[model samples]
Target: MKLKLLILLLISGYSFSQVKKPDSLQLFFDSAKFSITDAHKTQLQSFFKDIKLDEVLQIRIKGYTDFIGNHVYNNKLSKKRAKATYIFVTNNYQFKAIAQQGLGELDEEIAEATIEGGNSKHRKVDLILSYEKPKEVSVSLTRKQRYLLQLPKLSIGEKLRIQHTNFHISTPNITNASKEDLEGIIKILKAYPKLKVLIEGHVCCGDKEEYESKIINPDNLALSTERAKNIYNTLIKKGIKANRLSYKGYGFTRPLDFPENTIAIQRENRRIELKVLRK
Candidate 1:
């Protein structure tokens, strides 16, 4: 009866503590055990869910054991313990973690040994919440930023077209004017690292053949494909993983409006579209 009350108190206390800013916390384990109790694990997972950890940031996890085994064996056991928690987090949460470590056994002289139920106190893991500090630049989201934050909720088939009139002209060159827009995109990708997108390039239909013919390439696809590739290159240069992004071109093949429409509409048709492949 007393044990049940203690667990109830623990769960309630942790629930209250979550209202504050995230600080480092420890999750204790049983002797020779890597798995946390269902109650404790549920509490830990709830804490992570309550927080808004970006998909890009890597989580730090460390495991330690009691001074009951040899150093070599304890190290290996401690690592397994850490890995168990690591797998649990990755499988359940959106965040990616890298700093998984096993500190072997805790020194008995330095810390209190968990004497109640085998050395349970020292046999435990710690989760240190950490984040990558964004570059100190004053960046405010405009009304247009709704596209980035709310995009994941939209239909998967919807293609998000990016407009950079000053950057991607009828040609493939990307200029300084396009950098600001591209920077915003990079920030979005970083915030949601798990997202994958396909960059599609489309060109205005011209009187002769097609706008894709503007650039001659033996492969028969130019202008449009190059434009898409240019945006892909730009994102890669900005440190976004290449696997998360891809580029393709469809010269005047997919038109939103009539091909022979007003210059404004024509320009709209010729655009770089981000087809969100996965969230």
Candidate 2:
């Protein structure tokens, strides 16, 4: 317990110096248009790309709409605007958002305009970011921390994942322990519902051509592909939203810490790599 508290203090010490990237950003739609503009798309891409490595403590995206339309229409429009931005962010950054809400015409006293392209400012979505902070001196150390604590802020093109402890060379199954480990990731996704991830499956034994020839029963290509798909399905079966996850098979194409000579290294190769696509 003392060691755990010491580690928490150390992490909190580092977190105290960290700041949220962007702090706040926003997306605007054309009048009566709920879709994000292409210009805005480039802006968002550039903005998030710059902060790819920053630790994202919390993501909040709030959407708003002008009062030009009826209360019902405006409220729905605001949600659409927010959803578009949420999808865009998740598809690109793969960061799960803490909150995604539509404040439909809330706090707006604008005179309703019937003309086209009226009240552009209100048709917008705000992307707010929050950073980690140190626990108060008075606060007690606890094992239960935010879900983000267990996750690494995935880089744009970099591959990352929690290793499955129960993987077998003869099986294409995700073991019980592996499923439990994956449940931690589900919590992270729940915290950031709008986030999207690309799951890549890689296998060991030999290169692509070699696996095609050597591996019997289901082909080597199928082995990796099935693993990736199973992870994707497991998340779905466990009630994770389907739209947020994608999987691909790269059978022995991408290797880490090369010279995969040992059994441990080969096991490392037969693993899943989660890449951020939208956050």
Candidate 1, poorest ten consecutive residues by summed lDDT: 211-220
Q: What tens digits encode model 2's per-residue C-alpha lDDT throughout 173-278?
A: 8766676557666776776676688877777766544333333324656777888888899889988988989887756644442456798878776788676666
- Give one clash count per candidate, in the order shown: 0, 14
User: How accurate locally is residue 135 in candidate 2, as Cα lDDT from 0 to 100?
Assistant: 36
Runs with alpha carbons beyond 4 Å of true place in candidate 1: 1-140, 143-146, 165-169, 207-220
Clashing pairs in 1: none
Cα lDDT tens digits for candidate 1, 1-279: 999999999999999867655746678877787875797678787777657777336566788788665444577878888898888877777675556777666645335432345467788787777555433333355554535554443233335667653334557887776666777788778877777888877776543343323333323247878888988998999899999998887666444445455888777767788877777
User: How well does candidate 2 score on lDDT at residue 111?
Assistant: 21
The Cα RMSD of model 2 versus the native structure comes to 19.0
What's model 1's TM-score?
0.44
Regions of candidate 2 where Cα sits further than 4 Å from its true position: 1-152, 208-218
